[model samples]
Every structure is written in C-alpha cells, then in structure tokens.
Target: MPCDKSANADPKKEFFIDVITMDIDYPDCILDLIDNSVDAYTRSEIDDPQIRVTFGEDSLEIYDNCGGISEHDLLNTVFRFGGHVAHDSTDTLGIYGVGLKRAIFKIGNAFEFETYDGVNHNIVYENDLSEWKTRDDDEDGKWRFKVRAGAELDQETHGFSELRITKLKDSYKKMVTLDAKIIEEISIKYVLFMNRGLSFWVDNLKIEPLFNFEVLSNEYLQPSVKLLEKDGLKVKIVCTYNPRESLRSEREEGRYGWNVFCNDRLILLSNTTKETGWGELGNIAFHQLYYPFCGYVFINSHDVRKLPVKTTKNGLVTSDNTYKFILNEMWNQATPVLKYLRTSRLMDEETLIKDAEKSANEKVLQDSKLARSNADQKSIFSMNEKASFKAPDMKPKRKELTKIQYSRPTVQVDKVKRKLGAESNKKVGELTFDLFYDEECDDA
Candidate 1:
C-alpha cells in the first residue's frame, strides 16, 4: 500500500474566531490581553509596569506602558496567527501567540493597534482590521496583512501599546455593562501582582489588592503554612480559617475562601469562583466545608512544567494530579478548623465552653502530628499552633505567709552616771527613757 499525500486542516477565519470566543468569558478575554502585556513587560525589562483597561461606551481598550514591539517582532510574529515568538522560549506568559488576535476578534469585528518603542522614532506601527470583519470571501489561508508605519505617535512618551476594539457585536457590546463585575474580577485575579506593585486601572478607578498580609487581623486562626520541595522547585500552602461572623459584614462579601497563585500570578482569588468551592468537579461544598476557610497554594517555580495553570492562566487544571494534590492539602488542613468552628456553634450553651476547650486541645494535638511530616521551613503550611480561638482567663491563687519582727533593749545612761536597760524607750531633751521612766519622771 502507498500513501497518496499528507493534508493540513487549516481552519476558516470565522472558525478561528469562534474557537477563541467559544470557551472564554469576556472578562477572561481581557485577561488574555493582560497576559501579552505582561509578556511584553518581561521582554522589555520595564520597571514599574502599568496596565490600564478602559471600559468605553462604544469600545473596549487595554493599554500598557510596557515596551512597544520591536521591528523584528512586528514583522515576524506580532500579527501572525498561530505564530511562535522568540520570547515564548522564556518563562513569560501567553505562549500560544494568538491571544492578541483572538481577543481582538472576540471583542469586536474591528480593531486598531497603536504602538511605540522607547527608541527608534521611525518604528511606530498600527494595523486597522476594520475591513476584514466584513470580508467573508477571503479564506484564512489566503488572507494577508500589512502593518502601516507612522511618524512619532501622538503621545510624547516612549514605550507604549494601545489596543482599541470598536464596532462591537450586539451581544458583545454588553461588555461595557460589565464595569462593576470587571472591578471585582481584576481585584482578585491580580491580587498577588497588585500587592507586588502592578498598578491596574479600570476607567479612572485604580485597582488595588486587599490587605497584603498572609492572615487577617480579625478573629482568625493563625496561618497554617506548608512548603513542599522536590529538586529545586517549591510549592507553598498558606491557609487560615475565620468564623463566618467575621465576614458577616457586607464589605466581606467576596473575601472568603482560597486565593491560589502561580509564580506570583493569582489563579484563583479568594474562592469567589464556585469552581474552587462547590461545583460539578468539586467534592467540597462551601457551606458544608465550614464556610469561612481560605487557602492559598503558590508555585514558586516559574517553569511551566511545574506551574499548575490551565491555558487561560486563570485556574488550575483540576484533573492534573499535582493540582488535585494541592487542593487535597488545602482541604485537609481547612476541614479541621472549619469543623471546630461548626462544632462550637452547634454545642449546647452548658457544654459549649468545655467543648471548645477540649476541641482546642485536640486541634493542637492534631497539628503536632502533622508537624512530624513537614519541616519547619519548607512546609506548605505549618500545622496549627495551639487553638487559635481560645482566650486566656488568668487564674493564680495568692499565697499567705507570716512575718516576725525583733528588737534589742537599749541601755540608758543617766546624767549622774547610772546605767539601765529599757525594753521600750523615747528620747526627750537628749535623755532616753522608757514609758515607765516618764511616769517615774512625773513622780519625781
């Protein structure tokens, strides 16, 4: 038998657009643009990288102060679909190379790219794809692209890229209505980065991370930190459990649960996403898991092989064993603290205090057992250090002791040279006399 030929399954332009939008949410599409921004920043080695996502009435825009594309990148790969860039070899994000294009197509039928590198005044570039949105006859394989170069950009500053997408699809136009939702998503999605000085802005409102500490200052358990190391890679797990009452206030609405990160990028922010708590793939329910425990699993290694992130970089691959392993650890430590909280709540008033004390002791014992398997420094989370909720009631009894005093008799010398010893004496005009002596003086 002889094989006739090999064939390539090249997709149509429409199909390519569909593929990018099908599995993604609009918010995540915005994140794709940020991923490229981050990659650009990494390549340019820019300091104080800043990203702004604008929610416009008729358009959606994402702009970054990262270095603009170089001539090589612009000509060889910036606009090439399914193209691989040299930077991909590095550990920067957005490896698939179509994130920019996919995001552009998904958001609207028309888009314009404007960019400027800090140097090379003649290297500015812009590509307007407004006409391609209506051109259905040209197939993806035969379509061509030409980037138009322009003079110094309207802005005086160097090193910037601005992506503007307009002419939105009817349904996609609804993206503007997502300002409130995007604020929350960006806050959580980039909590790690924001806390580390990545400034993000929506419209004019700047996005900032929550308190930058590992544990809350309110009534919460001491953070449990565990570190796992194999070869040179490290994964850290830090967790804490707070009573639901602490979060009962409206301000704490979306602050409960896990906030997982990979190489300093937040994948899950505070378990706001139900997938991390209770969902089809999740075996644990938020309520059933005691309601207010959050764990942060961080992969210190930037190596893609060790980092547990889905293609979107917004979540972990639930099916991956290592991912599941981290989740399991989070559950294992969190379950006890939550159970303790629930148990304390359900106990009868008469037994609540005693039960709580007993539970605290038992928790410390369990933590001690866990401590055996983990090194003090390299563990994901340290086991519980005593009961975190118990308060001390000082109770020390006072001691009763007796005291004794001793005195010596004083010898008194009279002016006429007679000496006498007195048990008690007082001095009057240079003469020492006992109480009896005063009476004797009165008699004299």
Candidate 2:
C-alpha cells in the first residue's frame, strides 16, 4: 500500500472557546430565563427571595438578587447546555442549562444579561431568525447569533442579575394589558414559595399571599410514624369538610392531591383523579366522622412514585391499596371527633337555636356597655323597647296526621264455641256445683 497520511489522522476537531446557541420561541424563551433566575436565587441561600419583572411596549426586564454567576464561570460554562451546577443533585433546583437560552429565544429578538461577578461584566447577544433561515455554503452552519463584550459591571451591589429582552413578537403585544394578572396567577400557582423565601413583583404591585395555611408549620400535617430504614414508609391522613356549603358541584368528581415537595422545591403534583379509599369513606354526609374538607394527606420524605398511582402536575391516579390505607387511618382519627360533636349537641337544631338566643342576649348586654359613650343611647334603648312590643305572638305548628284505619282480629269465637259440646259441659258443671257451690247457692 502507498503511504497515506490522511488515513491515520484523527477526524475530530477541538475548540477552545465555550459558547453555544439555540433558537427558542419568544415568551417561552423568557420563561426559561426566569427559571434560571429562580435556580440562581435558590443556590444563593437568600431566604424568602423575590424576583422583579418590569416591561413596556418596547422592552422587558427581569431582575433578581440571587447569587449571580461568576465572571469566569459565565465565560466558560453558563451558556453551554448540560452545564448546570445542580445537575443530578436532589438538593438544588436546576437541571439542564437549556432554560436560559430557551427563554431568551422565545421572548425577544435581542437579549442582554448582566451579572455581578465581583465586578460587572455584561454580555449582550442578538438573534436574527431571518438570518438563521438563510445562510450560504461558505458561512458557518451554526445558527446566527452574535455575542460581544459589554461595559463595566458593578459588583459591590450584593449579588444581582438582569435580563432584558427587546424586539417583541406580535403575540406579546396583548400581554402588556395582562402583566399584573399574569403575575398574580403565577404567585398563586407557586404559593409554596412564600415559605421558601421567594417573592415576586410585577411593575409596582406586590403579589398577595394566596395560601390559607403556613406551608411548613400548618399546611404540612404531622406524620403518624417516621420511617427509620430505607424500606420504612410513613403515612399522613387529613380530612376536612364544609358544613355550611359545598364548594364544588356534585357533578364534579375526583381526589385532590397536592404537589409533593422535597427541600422546599416541587418534585411533582399528582395527575390522578380516582378517589382514594379514604376519600370515598370521608365523603359520606352521614359519616361526619371524617372531615371531608379540601386537604391532602402527604406521605412526606418518601418517593410517592412507589405507590401504584400515576402522577402528573395536575392530579393523581390512585390504586386500591393507597386509598384503602388512607381511608382506614382517616376514619380511625375522625370518628371520635364526629361522635364528640354529635354528643355535645353541636349538630342539633334546637341546641343551635338556644345558643343563638344566648349569643343575642350577650350581644345586647355588650351594646349596653358601649351605650355610655353613645350620644343616642336613650333613643337606641327606646327603639329596642318598641321592637320588643311589636314582636308578634306565634305558636309552633304541629305536623298533621293524614288518615286513620282499623282492622278486625283474624281469630274468631265461633270455632271455640263449636269445640265445646253443650250437654257434656252442663253435666260437668252440675257435678262441680253439688260439691262446692252448696253454700253460695243457699245465700243466693
């Protein structure tokens, strides 16, 4: 064989620089960038964190006081896919690095990021979708995106990063009117963040808290048992019901399970709708033993995926055992409470009326205490007397009976009369009279 230099040569090419690019649709790109902000905030250990969003007709900006990316890391790894520091680590909230770029590409034509890297070193990048579609053979096949050195960055400013997206898509034009509402919705959806030191703002309005209970202290029920070994399992059961009203229609059906979280971040929310055994037993009106209210029994710290239930972000698909176990525990706890309430006369109509009357009398006395400070105390007392005099005399109505009927007895005397022969009966009576009735007959 002739000597061939190319046959023995390595074909792979190596590059020294670390820049990667991908195209993303507008709002989606923006969302991915926000995810990056959230991950960064979580990593910094800044408790009760908040992210600020501001936008106008031409531009949109998101700012967060998270642990900003370091200058060296930003240049080398931040933009590259699969470069996340938290990958494969269950404690942290970040995964693939695609979120940052995906967010930028989805929302705007051009985007810039500035991070506090001891000193600020801003990076500006622009994407031209039209250029991406049309490139000649001589040009590099990679998508057309440009990155360049940015101006002096500030570092003394505790840690911060800002992403600004401009050159809006047509779909985003309507969003200008709904920015506040969107923030509100997101805040409600991620209400757990209120306990995790995460806060969100849109324009000037701060999102109000949406949860009724404290996430760590009250929202999470106490465990019945703790798992000591790898195979150990813990179960929690909670049931609540509305006594005065049904919040949902009777036509609506399904079990409502919460999003499970480990270390303050959401792992998954259930995607199933089948009622657990506990739900079926708890839902009965007569079995007020269990409060059938809107709450969840969270099996804390366990990988619930082990249960035979299909879970997605929306609902849970529960199997027989999971439901059965939950129902058994719930009934065990709730039955006593229901019995106590019933025995205490709390559920009785007459008891409630008496309690109401007592309450009203107490209120009147309380109002009299305040009358010393009132300018129209005498008039108020006079009005009370007049109202009492005008009260109508009424009697409680009794329920009426609809009809009455009587039936004769099935047994008759004719059969008994035929069984006794008259002649034999008289002879026996005469023999008895001769022996015992002599004194009674003489007196008669």
Candidate 3:
C-alpha cells in the first residue's frame, strides 16, 4: 500500500494513442497535376513563368521556375502528412496539400523531386514505392520518401524545381499523344492572358493564342438591347434576322449567344441542348426569326463564380428571374426581328401561296391603271398643235406569271413534340391550361 501504485503506472500505457489510416483513390491524377501546374504558375509573381511538361515512354516530368522549397522545410514539412505551407489564409492557388502527393501516387509507382534554394543550392527527395513493400513492419512506419543533400548549383540566380515520375501509369502513356492538343487548346482558350506573357509548353509544342472576339470597333452596326447592370456586371442583348437565308433549316441558319467567361477567358462556349429548358418553346421558330445572331450578357469575374455552372463546368443562364428579365428585354427589342425571320421562313412554304397570289394580283391592277393614264396623256398631246403620233402598244408586255408550287411546311411536328417533352421533364410543378370550344358544338 505504501508503494504508490498510481505513480508506478507505465507512462506509455497512461498516454493516449491514435492511429489514422487514410486510403484515398485518385482516378483523375494527371488532371489534378495539370491543375496544380496552373495554380503554381498563376501564383508566382514572376513576370512570365515557364511551365514545361515532358512525357516519355515510362516517365513524366514537370518543371516549373516558381520559388522552390528549402531542404529543411522540405524534410520537416513538405513531406509530412497534412502539411500545407499555403493555407486558407493564403490567396495562392495550391492551398490543398494533398494534391501533389495524390497526383504523384496516381501517375507513377516511384517519383523524385529536386528543388533549389539559393542558400542550399539543391535539395533532392526521392520516393520508391517498390521498396515500401519490402520494408519491415514497425510501430512507426518508415517515411515514404528519401531526402538528402544534393549537389550545389550556382546560387547567383533563382532556379527551378523538377518532378520526375517513373513507372508511368497506362493513362499517362495515352496522354503523351494528347498533350500537344491540350496545350494548343489551353493556349488559345487563355490567349488574352497569354498575351500578358504567360507561357506553357508540352514537349516541343508551344501553345498559341486564339482570341474569339475582335475589337469592339470591328463589330457591325445592329440594334441592341441592354438588360442588367449591377456593379461591374453588364448584360447586353442583340438580335439580327437574315432575310436572304432560311432560319428554319439547321444547315442555313446557326443560332448564337450564351457563352460564359471568367476574366475575359472563355470557360464554356455553347450551352444549348434538348435537355436544357431553353429548347422547350414551340415559339422557338418565332425566337429564331431574330436568331441569325444574338448578343451575350457579360458578367464580371467577381460574380462569375456565383453562376450556376454544371459539374462539367458548363455555365448556363436559366429561365430564372435574373435571366427572365434579361430575356424579356431582349425579346421586346427582338420582336420585330423575330417576326421578320418567321415571316421569311413562312414565305418559303406553300401555305403562304394565297398571300403571294394576292400580292401579284395587286401589282397587275396597278400596271393596268398606269397604262390607261399614259394613253390619255398621249391623246392630249396629239390634240396640241402638230404633235407626232405615238404608238398605242409601245410599252413592252409584262412577263407571264411563273406558277410556283411551294412545298408543304414540313412542320417537323414530331421534333417539336420531342423537344417540348424534354423541356417538360425539366419543369418542377404541374401545369394547367384553359380550353376554348365553339358555342355551336353540342357533341361532347
């Protein structure tokens, strides 16, 4: 009893113990790495940061000229689990610490990293997954990567870091063929920013800029409607009808408008689909009449993230009040143009033949009246002193009317029904409508 049993208890047994086993799967590893590259490039304050992605048969390397990690920082923090030098307070792009490790683990079975700090010259870290399997089991598992002092390079200027991932996953190999195209598209998509001096290269291919819109001065003069404006956000609508072409035929007239951008960089180009609510209106023909062209509403970068973009990152402005107001303003301004397109499409059909025939008949009567007036003027001139006699039928005969047989409207009723059906599926509530009947009808 005098031994003080409580004081004799083992310190280890008295202490709390916690074991965490985290298993995360990374199916989209390469995509995550590319996003990380974008983050690193965008965060660096360098005038023009260069990001190089090289793909080889069994290895992949990504090198960036951004600030490199120090040897001590790398060992003590960078390689540690839950390590994030950049956190929520940081405005930098790569705040999530798990991205790099998960990216590396997904693409390669083994990976190595080399970073340069002016003071240390070069710090190297290598991780071989193959060796982890052979290592002895222990209370504290051995760290995944190896870190050591690296050969010194000249410290007069800042240097870059290189990440080499070997034992490449099969998907990485397929990406080698597509990397060039991806770089080209990315370059074009971000051309405006690219012009500001950001450069990205994949293998030997350099990305080139492709701008979508020309300068404002280059746009043609057309009636336009202004919709919404809040702070820096502005929405303008424009509609134009081409009388020379038929809008009803898909091959002739192409519908335009509805593009989404962030900071003048286009994120999604077109969002029209049958599944979308926009396709539902039977009055789309009326809408398209003004549709040979339409203008887009511009939302500034600050509010862009608020937009309802799909999981695929496709942004769409729906029939909500915000969009409805804009559409109403646009539709009011476009009513005339929409009528024009509808009339033009209608005039091409056989049902409008009666109207065409009436127009032709009016022209014939007008010509006859003109002829009688000319004849009376000639008679009056002949009565005047010694006027030369004029021929009665001197004017040329008008050409015979060419009977044009217009085809039936080819209404595409099924297509319209299918489109409406799809649109109805998107509706959240029930619908009610009133039916009108003739007073003379007694039959039920």
- Give me the overall lDDT of model 1: 0.58
Better of 1 and 3 by TM-score: 1
Residue 415 displacement (Å), model 3: 6.6
Model 3, span 1-444: residue lDDT tens:
577456533223112111111233222344345544554555466756776778787887887776666667676666554565553222222333555666675567788787775566544445565455345435564344666666767766665677888887675566534565556556544554466566767786776665333211101223333445544345544344222233245522122433344334444443344222244444343233233433333343233333433212223446435545444554555445443333323222222334435456544334334323323222111121321111111122333654333222335534543433323321201111100111233323
**TM-score for candidate 3, residues paired by index:** 0.50
TM-score of each: 0.64, 0.51, 0.50
Which of the predicted structures, 1 or 2, would earn the higher lDDT when compared with the native? 1
What is the Å distance of residue 337 in model 1 from its true position? 3.7
Q: Model 3: which ten-residue window has the lowest total lDDT?
A: 428-437
Name the runs in model 1 displaced over 4 angstroms: 1-8, 42-48, 84-91, 120-144, 153-156, 216-222, 229-233, 243-255, 272-289, 300-307, 339-444
* Evaluation by TM-score, superior candidate among 1 and 2: 1
Candidate 2's residue-wise lDDT over 333-408, tens digit each? 4444333322221222232334445555544333222321223212111121111001011112223634433333
Best-matching candidate per TM-score: 1
Clashes of each: 9, 25, 0
Q: How should the candidates be ordered by lDDT, best one leading? A: 1, 3, 2
Task: Give the alpha carbon lDDT tens digit for every residue of 1-444 in model 1.
Answer: 779887977566666667776887777788878777766665666568888988777788888888887767766677777665654334566656777887777777666777778654322222445556335544534655546665665555758888888877677775555777778877776666676567888898998775453443322224555667643346676665443333243425234577777766677766734455343243334542234555666675545555667877867777776666666666665655554543332212223334435456544343333322222223223342322322111111222645434334333223211221111232221223322343355431
